[model samples]
Target: MLPPIPVLADYGISPTHGFLPDVLPLTRLPDPYYNKWEAIAANLQALILSKRLRGVVDRLPVLDTIGLEHDAEWRRAYSLLSFMAHGYIWSGDSPSDRLPPSIAVPLLKISEHLEVPPVATYAAVCLWNFKPLFMDEDIDNLENLATLSTFTGAIDESWFYLVSVAMEARGAPIIPLMLTAIAAAREADAATVTRCLHTFAERLDDLTTLLQRMHESCDPKIFYDRIRPFLAGSKNMADAGLPHGVIYEDGSGKEEYRQYSGGSNAQSSLIQFFDIVLGIEHRPTGEKRGRPQEQGEGHAPAPKHNFLLEMRKYMPGPHARFLNHVQSVANIREFVEEHRDDRPLCIAYDACLAMLRALRDKHIAIVTRYIVLPSKEVRTRSRSRSPEAVRRKINLATASRQQPPGIALDTRGDGKKDSLKGTGGTALISFLKQARDETGEPAVEAWAHRFMSRVIRTEGQGDFFAGKPEEGAGLQVASQTEEAVIPGLAASWTVDDDVGGICYY
Candidate 1:
């Protein structure tokens, strides 16, 4: 018999999408995507109430199960999180305000469990604290970069800024500011110098805040030690093989040393993002060839990037399977009651929030499996059992992980040129509009495949690939992305990337 990996197969990920995490499905959402999310929110709470569901940490005191199922604020936060993860906020004009006040409220509430005091403060801000300062940039042009920093206080709060100054010559204030902060902190005799753990704690607020926003996107295990700790920078990627650590204002090294940051091991894969989109690099059925290099150099092991897997420590079971579907987040009372005193409250919250955040992430994974993963296997029917084939699947998976990320290409092509149409972008929107307009779940999902294919091909193409369609395949490659196939166009379509596939006209 095959291992019970029924859900694992559902995580749509492969070389074409690169290391991109799964997207959540609010696609079942109603039209004007935001409204769809709102409707789903009502239904989500209904489902929770209907089932009388219990979160994994039912014993945690912070949670009040009595009213959670019907909580409006909680439901609102869940809807917004769904927006951030799955809802298409872009109205095709400028970058939509991703972090609304509604989002911020829950975000701060959730951060209690994330990082420690000062350090994680740096990480959370490093990732999100700068959003207000950076979001309004002219998407019409990339060169119109905004001023990087807009806050008062020392370099203590913003570490990535300092790092940028250390690295980028054009960026100023970071070095001079760091020097000034060090001087000030030293004069005051504050423990400006601390460990990476302290730094992570600082960012925990943002981390947990984001968690509360997502409610429970991640599995608990990953949220804590891996995701939140790293966000704080208390832990190095070398823990996952992080490259280095930053120097505090007081000239104290959090560690006697840090890896990947400034050492010989610095700037390594653990810190560098290895995009696994477009086409994944994998070994052939018989022999190995060129593969995407592992996270680090020659002999170093491949890094495990899934933060949720680490959070398994705190979660209960069947519970694991059941909670897999829920992401609104754990109530604080519940979190406190479950782990008890074995771990610090903030750290536990970080773990809790991470799991909540991961629900959206897993949603992305499912998309990759559905859309791009098939770009790999090229099969319609899913093979759940059969040991030999399962062994091959496992072998490929094992090899994909075991072998350095090879630039190996799986040859089973749909033979259709990659396009916006191939990407299902427009089709997705159409499907949402159609399903929402028609009403009834059965009617909506019935033609989902047809809608998905049309959208993937229509909206997914353009710059990610530029090639002519073979006769009838509907692909008309106007331009080929210079940036390799694995990190394909759709794969790299960030707000910054040009080939986002949105047709304004």
Candidate 2:
């Protein structure tokens, strides 16, 4: 018999909240001893605004984690220190390379308990940083939710975080739903599995709608210019001024540099769970289609590092374990392939992938509006200014000072902006487009497969290819083009519009 599908409670996952805290996140720590951290978090926006966060944090006395009694308190402490840590690191004229023991010491302890990095993560910013506006209202409703902390204290920042929270809440049902499908698959019950997949596709459509709602409250310009910089991680940020990652000084007089990717939606367990249950695999950035075995003659090649798998390290401990357990028993894809003669089951299975691809398409459009367009504007504005004028604007909070790695303010000889990397240190647009394309790889129907994998072309351009391309040619060529096709989505831009930039949500 297949090993049992993982139980949600065993992994501290909630049936109603998904990866969000089973209990509401503490608004304030009950223990008074850690008030300094709380105070810093409470005043973080003002401190960052006045450029005093670093000095205040430097003068703080290191506090012990003993006062944090419960898991909620531990989570609260983690959220507080994470906000302060990022604020301090990026609050000065340049990103700080060294973290004081006051923040670094307890943060490391809390992170160890949580099995995440000491730096801020998606869990810190979204999962553990939100509260319902009214106790009686649904937390999944965007209007009813509010963020507990933010770097700039702007509605745009809170909106960015809350949208993810709402998604997690709305997507909570998909966990048990897919686990049920897995059990039905084991029993060879196609009807139950089909029903589950239909519901799963509907929930995915709901999520896509929620994602598009990002524009309702959050302004793109504010997000790219003010909030995006604070979310950056030290890894791949040599251009942002920290050649060596931040040094966490623990008062041992011997400190080591630590590198970690910043908070990213890639770290969210909800999205990964969807991929796992649906049996979608993501190869590493720049990897071409094909089996790993094809790379070598009569020998299996070593596995390339998959970015999505790497992101699990950034998720909370129990949540990551939950994904691992679920992966072991995910039978939906296998079952659907086995029963392709069952038309409804195959259609339902393919529908889920279609909705997922649409969600990714929406995300790419949002990234274009928020990160890519604003980056061009910043580049243009900087180009028209004198060197001294640009220099005067290079403060800690200034977004222009820290362009993501591989993104240069100046254009290349081809007059195209350099490619951008996400805060998680992967190629930004290419990574997203590749992931979207990979979502269609498991379609049950040949027609669905062709539709999902078709190369999108401009209005007048001929069809690039009708079906999945040969292992190393078509998709790879499409990825290299300036206007990369988001599989099944058309392109409209020229070569001159080839600027790139990063996004997290």
Candidate 3:
């Protein structure tokens, strides 16, 4: 039914159970295989720190699965590949957008077998690596899902990953919900479509509500000060922190510092699924749409380089294709339009759109606090003061080894000149700006703007609608506005004229 919602079998403990991957067993590694990979990851981090990652990665022993027969071994392999790939791509003097064969080749083979991607992903960081205390129970039932292992072995790192795991668990039901809708749509069952839309809207609202729970245990101060810094990419991150890189400890007192972007929500499939299902078309940040007259002058496919979509390359292979299918069949609006005579279908569909828009709006708010304000403050002080003073302010040196677990070591002031250029390097601001632009007014205004625009076109035509809403009862449409950038933030934000949504600085 509906192609069984594609699954990457090798990556799952149960290949037939839809998109869920196996969680790491809540126990110790029974052999030396996992420990050996940890050592490799540690050494790779060292090579990255010395600016010699390519030479070593190119010479890495070909991946052998002699000891990788267990779930733990598979998880370790995923972790090892994630470290190697991230180091190769972002540890460069600048961010290398392309994956070199050194990291890509073995990673591709292993990931294809595991049903994941060749790069770091949410699956690598969260899904396949976590271990719940009770094997039979869900991870959300546990207070700690960090018993297995982590790249940096820091509590903050564990916390960062656990948030995603919790969110994934919360949103897991939507998979069946959407798939059921797809089946109903195929049969042209208006009643079934209406029911599914209403359920989908309720689920989306639940997801948005769950998103607010990020603040519950994941303290903002801890996240912004301790955790956020670890997740910074090397792209536009010179001014923020970790100018050279982060020193990862291997527990034997052999600490190795390497430049890395760490894990981020940019790689989250949950958000990507929302984009796919809602028909939210995203362009790369800073790229403007051509005018209507210039739309097809050359008929050449406009080059698209959206960073968010680029992150999909890092998703599990089957997972990425599932999103592709969802996008291809985004027919809720079309179905509703065809059933203009059916008030129930239109109301349910509009409610679904409103919920989706609200989710985007909530994300924009998060980006504002997590990226915009901090970057704005950091850049303002950097410009108004000397380099040394700026460094002192942002780089408050917490004790090196005494740092809490998951807290990344400060790698700045090593007399190393940062080779990456641009303001996004200083903080999360750059990535957040792009994310905000991607999620802003255009997506939020879809149903509201579209429904009104259609109504306007059919004006003076009696009964453009075969059915009307009950008196004083209709779809509640949220308003969109022009993109309003926070003052003095040095982000290259382009607001779409047709969409009205605010990206608060």
Q: What TM-score fits each model?
A: 0.20, 0.87, 0.61
**Model 1 misplaced stretches (Cα beyond 4 Å):** 1-114, 117-454, 459-479, 484-505
Please write out the lDDT profile of model 2 over residues 391-424, one tens digit for every residue. 6443212334334434334368997655444433
TM-score of 2: 0.87
lDDT of 1 by residue, 307-326 (tens): 21222211212222322221
Best by lDDT: 2
The Cα error of candidate 1 at residue 256, in Å, is 4.9
Off by over 4 Å in 3: 1-18, 22-30, 38-63, 70-72, 80-119, 141-144, 151-155, 233-262, 286-305, 377-386, 389-447, 450-505
Provide the overall lDDT of each model, using Cα atoms, as 2-decimal numbers: 0.24, 0.78, 0.49
Model 1, position 441: C-alpha lDDT score: 14
Model 2 CA deviation exceeding 4 Å by range: 291-304, 393-425, 462-505
* RMSD of candidates 1 onward, in order: 27.3, 6.4, 12.5
Task: Rank the candidate models, highest lDDT first.
Answer: 2, 3, 1
The 10 consecutive residues of candidate 3 with the worst lDDT sum are 395-404
